[model samples]
Target: MSNDHRRLGRELDLFDSDPLVGAGLPLWLPGGAAARHEVESYLYELERRAGYQHVYSPALGKRRMYEMSGHWHNFADDMFPPMRIGDDELVLRPSMCPHHALIFKARGRSYRDLPLRIAELGQMYRAERSGVLGGLSRVRSIALNDAHIFCPEDQASAEVAGVLRLMREAHEALGMGEVSYQLSLRGPGGKYGGDDASWVRSEELLRGALSKAKISYADARGEAAFYGPKIDVLVADPAGRSWAMSTIQIDYHQPERFNLEFAGADGRRHRPVMVHRSLAGSMERLFGHLIEVHAGAFPVWYSPVQLAVLPVGADQDDAASSFAADALAAGLRAESVHDGSIGARIRDAAGRKIPYIGMIGSREAPDGLVALRLRDGRQLDPMPQAEAIALIASIAAARSQELLP
Candidate 1:
């Protein structure tokens, strides 16, 4: 019960909430921003390697777009009110699938481009009630790690399974403890957009994917998104709390609403099934869970300050600065610490959860060597400064969970 994100988030200066800014909107501090940049860059690279075409869409869309996507009818309560422009209304998008649908229809597509995977690390706003908002866990603004895969209906199952694997891989790399799957379905009395037949088809496609992937999941009714049924990935944090950290939704309704079409093998236009997924959900939710589970000491690659160079005293400050520069040149996040006594500075860096502390004492400085100290209290033998920098850079580059590879 004590592993509250709000408790450690403030302690680590990751994010802050202010009354003037309104509830449910938290500001990421410098340290938090650095950590976030690392995480986002990793996600983008991972997506790129997997053949996803990254795209940028605007934060606001024409009000008619949501109406066309059916979010206006079924999900209006969760979305913010539209802004009035000159003879038009623009609304902050609550989801990216609608925009991606427009992208798919922007040009004629052939069967050669069966699976057009589009990804975006984008933002969405929610009109969350004041009483229900807390920390980064439940925020008004969400930066989603989202993608939409448009493919033929016959290939939907395979695409869903592939996304499930991607989600697991991402969760494991992020140090999320135990990842589980849930099949979220439409239940009675919900303002869902799709009809019974379409909902059944969506649920069946998702179920086929789970079976194909050999994944076991629990059924959660009324947890489905307004547009379709989804498979939700739950991460059980260290505190024994399970949170929904990722999602894969199979949607047939949006395509029908938007009339998305592609040229088929037989020279006929066909509808493309949309598969919406977010590997690690939103940045706020992911970091909130990470803060509580990792307890402020993140994995080496995503650690805000990967290496903090510590000089034994003022006499060794020059050596420390030079070593830090070497690490920075190697693309490792490094900073030279020279504000206080050597022991005090070491303690400060360690307390801040800096992964590796390169110590430049009198002996090491004279010989151009360094001593590496891990956050977990392991001390490596003195080695050449380049060797130490390589060790640290290698670990960070590989995104290894271990402090030392």
Candidate 2:
């Protein structure tokens, strides 16, 4: 088995640690940035299609927000120390729920907005212990694919089901098929925010939703959040280790604590139920998991450099440049490396685990053909550039790792 940290980042030139910036933070190298952008774009597109209105909130907030959300009491230990801005204390946001609640409060809500889904690709900060920091998994600063749905109590089940469907769709799109779900509940004597009846009712609703969906899940009795029970999606690595990647949670207490209310059809004020779900719990953790799961061999869609064009010599530079430009314009990520022999160039591309490698030498240049080498060690005879580009694009859009014929 491979040591978890040895697979990617450095090997693929994705990212590295900077002592000057402190531990638990990552400086994304060019390759790593590209991979992150691809994942972010995927999430943005998915959420957009699911009717979520994307928004951005500040990374830091007044201390009163956390106190109102009860995070100050329960999660203070994981929070960074507050900064003194005059008499007010400003703390880095460890989570975006409180901010989102403020947004709902700012706009007078009604039953007409019952199922409002707000999303953000939020950057969050947490104070993780130094020892637990490794690559991108346990980072201090991370991006979260976070969304919250505010619905009437009666609409709770449907909203939870909707979030689950979105999560499943995202996982399938990303080629993560072996994911498992866990329903985490509050333990005895846990410092939860709501009453016994409230907790029980919300838990039942969540359970029913998961059951109706026919999703296989495990139950964790003592692992719930202070304010709610949650359904966590766990993705296993190639080495058989499970990582928590997505979460769907029900919060009945926060709206009450924040005094969040909406007018019902009966013309009565009632508290709205809140569902906090993250398809990718945090980009940092997801990237780290992807590195281990793929063993640095990212699929075509997520690979930093999908293809590399290697010309035999300086004389072939023009052809290599032309090929790289054509591929780039066609929405295929490609680069040209013309300083090395054909064999060395191929080895370099292989080392990077690039999905495709094209060799342009004198023999193939005249006929407008390029020899294609796939990651799985298969070679195709000289093929037209358009066919190769189309083939690569199809593989990327479908997120297929297998080589094209």
TM value for model 2: 0.96
Error of 1 at 2 (Å): 5.1
**Per-prediction TM-score:** 0.97, 0.96
Positional deviation of 326 in candidate 2, in angstroms? 1.2
Go through the candidates in order and give the clash count of each: 0, 0
What tens-digit string does per-residue lDDT give for candidate 2 at 1-405? Answer: 463643567878888887999998888889989988998999999889988999999999999989999999988999999999999999999999999998988888889987889999999998999988767777999889999999998899998998889888877666655788999998887778988888898899999999999988899988998999999999776567677889989998889889998888899998999999999788878887777767788889989999899887777789889989999999988999877567887888998989999888888887777888899899898898778888899989887656663
Reference-based lDDT, residue 263, model 2: 86
lDDT of 1 by residue, 1-405 (tens): 466778778877888988899899899998899999999998898889888999999999998999999999998899999999998999999999899999888998988998999999999999999888878888999999999999999999889888888887888788877778899988888888867888888999999889888999999998999889999988765557677889999898899999988899999999999999999899999999988778889998888888999898899989999988988888888999899777898888987888888888889999999999989999999999888878877887777889876
* Model 2, runs deviating above 4 Å: 1-3, 237-241
